[model samples]
Target: MRIYLKGLRIYATIPRIKDANKLAKYYTETNKELGIDVTLDKISAKEFIKTAIVNFNSMKEFHFGIYTKNHKFIGLFSIIQPNYSKRICEIGYWIAKKYREKKYGEDAIKIITDFAFKTLKMKKIFAFVNTNNKASIRLLKSAQFKKTHTSLKSATAFEKTGTHISTYVLHLAIYSDTKV
Candidate 1:
């Protein structure tokens, strides 16, 4: 899928296996500071790539390579289960360290949301954010996502260091008749 959100200075395009290494490195380098875990290590790159390919090809999910106007690889933005019969989908995105404060995340979300509404004909889109992630919360809010629900003490199998996150769900109505 391809989407252009002019005001955000970014666009979303289909991802490729060639992006795996850079994407992994970007995630590994930024997770410590960002308190997020969304990548596979170098040793797991092959498996990750295969999984990404399957998710893209079989699941009908649009995994976009988030890029800058100058064609720099910023991060990833995607909608999972895009062909859901309920007309609902979830938004997932992350930006590399250097691009965090530049509003690339927000711009990427806007583009993806627009695609979901305009192209996919989705009724609504949702996102689950950790409560501690202020930047993500701000991005969702700026995109007009309203908090619809919350889950306390959500499970985190990856955090052996005892990380417990509160999950907050934000919903965006496709037919709101308002620009995001």
Candidate 2:
């Protein structure tokens, strides 16, 4: 499936093993900013690709590759650790550093949220942004996700990564901010 939004296209097909270098490069580049634990360099693309395949194929996780209208790699969006019975999922995404401030994140969120409900049949989806990550908070807010709660000293991912976090949630059944 390809979702077109704001001139950007999100391709639902997961990258193949031959695209290992591309995945690895992306991981090494965005690992710090996105709080990922992988250190695989370009040479280790195979391992990174392997992990992605395992998570995607076996864990019931969904990942989409972000692309341009012309089909250029821009970023990634992952519906991680879904609970099928609960109809709940968490969205984790990161746009390339160069794509910052381009409104792509907002567009992607809107499209993905729609896909989550209409295609995935999900009831609720959520995102967690570090309090200090003002940009992401603004992005999520602009996407119409309600700021549900803030946790103090809650994050333990990276050095100086903000502990204060705000959880933003979206519910299809209650678009008017009804209590969940």
Candidate 3:
């Protein structure tokens, strides 16, 4: 399936192995900013691609590729840890370094948030943002996600050594009434 936003197209399709090199490069370039705990010392793009395909097929999570209207791959968005019984889920996303601050992240969030609330029938969606990732915090706010009082301390090295994570949430009821 495909979702189109103002300057972006989001695809519910697995990325091809051929796109791995670029993705790996992005991973290498943005490791610090990504806030992932794993060390990609030897990021095997092929392996990553295979895992992505497997994960998509497993139905455990939903991953979408973010692209330009012209089909240029720029980033990824995901609805993770969905609890169907609870009607809640968490969101995750990363834009390539070159695409940072261009509002692609904001657009992608809007698209995914809509998908979660409307299609997945989720009551609420939340995102855990690194406290220091101002760009992402701003992006989430732009997409109408409000910060909750909750916070998490890093169990591992996340957010480039930053120790705290900020939680943000959006409810279906709130999103339904917003004009954005």
Candidate 4:
């Protein structure tokens, strides 16, 4: 099954094989420093697309391609490792370099968070963000996700040994209270 979720400036939907080339190109062009836990080695675009398809079909992760109202491919947003019994899940996302800082990420987060709580019946949705990514930190906070804690973790390609990763959570109650 595929999902099509809409927001003010963008919409998210499951990726098709036709989208693989574009998505792969975006992955190759994007700077690795965009996210702290970004992949260290670049995978061939087709291979990455294949993996995305496998994950989606296997129910391993819910991957959505973020696009503009006019159908411009912007980036990706995902629900990771959902725990139905516990009513919880994790989220991860990234925007193309040119699309950053324009509130697209904020809108995507809100859309996916709403889906998790309302459609998927999740009680909590959380994110693990690199502490050094100020833009992401700000975006999450603006979406009303509370900072639970920060911890140092293994280095990523762009980070040093003691990189700090912060965990943020948005419970259904908080989302309900702030949702308009």
By lDDT, is 1 or 3 better? 3
Residue 147 local lDDT, model 4: 82
Q: Best by TM-score, which number?
A: 4
Across 1-180, the per-residue lDDT of candidate 4 in tens digits comes to: 666899999998876656667776666566445542444223455566567678877867788889988888888888888778888888877888888888899889989898889888999888877678788789889999998852322222244456766788898998888865
**Model 4: ten consecutive residues of lowest lDDT:** 150-159
Candidate 1 regions exceeding 4 Å error are 1-8, 34-39, 42-54, 57-59, 150-175
lDDT of each: 0.67, 0.66, 0.72, 0.76
Clashing pairs in 2: none
* RMSD to the hidden true structure, all candidates: 4.0, 4.7, 3.5, 3.5
Model 2 CA RMSD to the hidden true structure, in angstroms: 4.7
Per-residue lDDT value at 141 in model 3: 88
Q: Which prediction has more favorable lDDT, 1 or 2? A: 1
Residues 24-107 of candidate 1 have per-residue lDDT tens digits of: 787677666655566567657656656666777665776778878887777877777654676777777779877788878877
Q: Which residue pairs collide, candidate 4?
A: none
Give the alpha carbon lDDT tens digit for every residue of 1-180 in model 2. Answer: 323434354443454556566666666778866675766656576665566667765657766666656556667677776777888778888777886677777767766676677666888778877778888788877867787753322222243444755678888866535323
- The weakest ten consecutive residues by lDDT in model 1 span 151-160
Model 4, C-alpha of 43: deviation from truth (Å): 8.6
Count of residue pairs whose backbone atoms collide, per candidate:
0, 0, 0, 0
